[model samples]
Target: MTVHLVGAGPGDPSLLTVAAAELIRQARVLVYDRPSMDAIAALAPADAETHVVGLRRGHRALSQPEVNDLLVELGRRGDVVRLKSGDPFVASRGGEEAVALQNAGIAVNVIPGVSAALAAPAAAGIPLMLRQNSVTATFVDGNDDDEHAEPPDWHALARLGGTLVILTGRGRIRRIAAKLIEGGRAPDTPIAAISAASRASQQVLRGTLSTLPAPLPPPVTFVVGEAAALELTCTSPKAS
Candidate 1:
């Protein structure tokens, strides 16, 4: 049995990779997280067995370990399509699942998709790097579940002086901003938050580190540094 670990892109169904779509179509068992992925999940054939492991309003949510177990069980039956938001390896816990499946002797294939860390900034018209302004781009997970995971060194990050992209940081942005400032970043350093990236309902909020408004919503990506101040996608007025 083989399991296909596919990245579903950000939120737009059209962003799904051709390989991902083809795998879903042939999936005998389909597994995905979050309701936002329903549009992508719908690509599976009518007879495919489906499972939603992410938290939902009324339904019980499965822990990562449980989901891993479930995938192992399903993999024994036939080809399984496991759809993860954004790129499978980008803060999606897909690596852990892959490890679990491997330990269980299941074959696996991984398909890449666009990650929100890149898409959110682009969709909001912010470049992650500019030759003159920013030469480095750092991506970090703002929400860490493992107590053992070394906490991010905000001071070093502030001193790194480049573009910083924080995923899953919506709820703790205010605190994170404070830490950055305490770490030596300028209070007026530009910061932007983008939510529902690439979707019709996407929202972008731009401000300095000290002035960013309250968190927009969950699934937000925060861009910090000089590049955040540039709106490269803005249409210029007709040349006079």
Candidate 2:
């Protein structure tokens, strides 16, 4: 039996690849995360056994050691499907899990899916790599508990004029922007907040580093730099 690490994409159900959809339909047992799992589970076989791995707000989750053991144990008994939000390996910890399974002598493969880092800005009409707007880009998870204790070399990113995409940063956007601006990013540097992107209800908000909202951004994805200058024409930005 093989272990399949699948990507649930960002929200829109139709975005699941044809192969991934078929696997979901045939899986006998599936393991997934909470709240985010419902939409993807709806596509699973009616009789599939579902295991929910709930992560409390800022609380400890199933330890990686526990998860690795579970995969080894489960893979030995039957086929297993490990579903993840967005792309499996895109900052979702799926890679680490996949590696554990492989090291345990289990066959494993990852199914690619749409990631919010790219989809969020697309739904907002912003090209992450616009020829005229930006030459390079980087992505950071702002939701990290210690995002900037020392911080990445903002000076380097600023010098190269690379685009910065931040995910899970709902709480630290204002501070992040300040650092970038201080390092060299213009205070007026273009910034956009995208939430629930790629779905019918996708929303976006555009402003400058200096005009960010008071409460700061959300678990949403952030796009900054010249790429922020792309003329996004998808859904209009929600009123601030």
Candidate 3:
């Protein structure tokens, strides 16, 4: 038996890859994270045994060890599908799960999904990179425990001359903005926060590095750069 690790994309069911959809239909045991269930969880077989192992910022429905054990146990019985939001390897902790399953001698397959880093900004009409002002795009996980142990070189990032995409940073935007500005980013550099990205509930908030709008809910994507200033209108920012 094999355990398939699939990406559920950035909360839009339509963004689910064909392979991911098929895997869900074939799953005998469907294990999912928080965001995947919001849209594509129902795609699983009617008889599929579904489990939620959602890991939130301060809450965890199922601990990592428990989830890994569950996957191994289920993998021995039949086809198992582990659905995670965004690319399975992109901050979803799929790598650790994959290693756990491998060590347990279970075959595993990983299916890549559209990352929110790109989709969120695009859905909100923010170009990640522009020929005029941006030549590179950098993605950093603002909430990573490992990252927190060692402070990032904001000054070096400011000197990179590109766009910055920060995922899961809604709670720390104020501090992050200050760091970027201290690193040399202009206080007026455009910044945008997109919440519930790619879903019907999507909301975009516009501001600058030093002048962020009022706080929004979690699961937010923050874009900072000259590119964040563009208003292509794909999705307009609501009034702050």
Candidate 4:
């Protein structure tokens, strides 16, 4: 038996890769995370066995080790699909699972999907790169542990020109923004806090380094840069 580790994209079901959709259709046992669960689960066959490994802020339904064990257990029975939000390799622990599965002699297939680092900004009408505004794009994880473990070098990041996309930064934006400002980033640098990106409930909050809204909802994507201020004409209302 084989297991497929798939990225479910940034919430918009239509954004799922063609291969991801096909795998869901053929899956006999599906393991999924919280984001975009309803939409992705619907794509699976009616008889498919589903296991929800609820992953949320402040609450983890299943530990990574547990999920990996479950995948190994399920793979031996039938085709298992491990559905994760965003690109399976980005932030999602699909790589760890793949390693575990491989060690157990189970075949693994990885299907890449759109990551929110780029999708969230585009969906919110914020271009990440532009000829004049920005020349680079950088992604950083703002999870709570990030400040203590493998913290980003805000001073160096400030010197690098481009866009900064922070994922899982809802609670750390103020502190992180302050650090960036202290690192020489302008206090008035444009920033956008995008919540529920690409979903019907999506919301984009625009402000400067010192003016971003407090307590932004979880699962937010923060875009900070000159490019964050440019709203392209082709952006749709649904992006808001």
Please give the ranking of all candidate structures by TM-score, highest first, separated by commas: 1, 4, 3, 2
lDDT (CA) for every model shown?
Answer: 0.88, 0.76, 0.83, 0.84
Residue-by-residue lDDT tens digits, candidate 1, 193-226 = 8888888777788899999856686689999998
Instruction: Choose the strongest candidate by lDDT.
Output: 1
Off by over 4 Å in 4: 55-60, 144-149, 233-240
Q: Which ten residues in a row have the lowest lDDT in candidate 2?
A: 231-240
Against the true structure, what is each candidate's TM-score? 0.94, 0.84, 0.89, 0.90
Clashes of 2: 4
* Clashes per candidate (backbone, < 3 Å): 0, 4, 0, 0
For candidate 2, the per-residue lDDT at 236 reads 43
- lDDT for model 1, please: 0.88
Screening candidate 2 with a backbone cut-off below 3 angstroms (N, C-alpha, C), the clashing residue pairs are: 125-232, 143-168, 170-217, 170-218
- Model 4 lDDT tens row, 41-148: 888999888888886567778977898899999998878888988998887778889999999999999999999888889888888888888889999877756433
- How do the residues 29-65 of candidate 2 rate in per-residue lDDT, one tens digit apiece? 8888765557778788888888776575665567667
Ranking of all predicted structures according to lDDT, beginning with the best and ending with the worst? 1, 4, 3, 2
Candidate 4: give the clashing pairs: none
Evaluate candidate 2 by giving its C-alpha RMSD to the native, one decimal: 3.9
Instruction: Report how far off residue 213 is in candidate 4 (Å).
Output: 2.5
Question: What TM-score would you give candidate 4 relative to the actual structure?
Answer: 0.90
Total residue pair clashes for candidate 4? 0
User: Candidate 1 clashing pairs?
Assistant: none
Show model 3 residue runs off by greater than 4 Å: 55-60, 147-151, 234-240
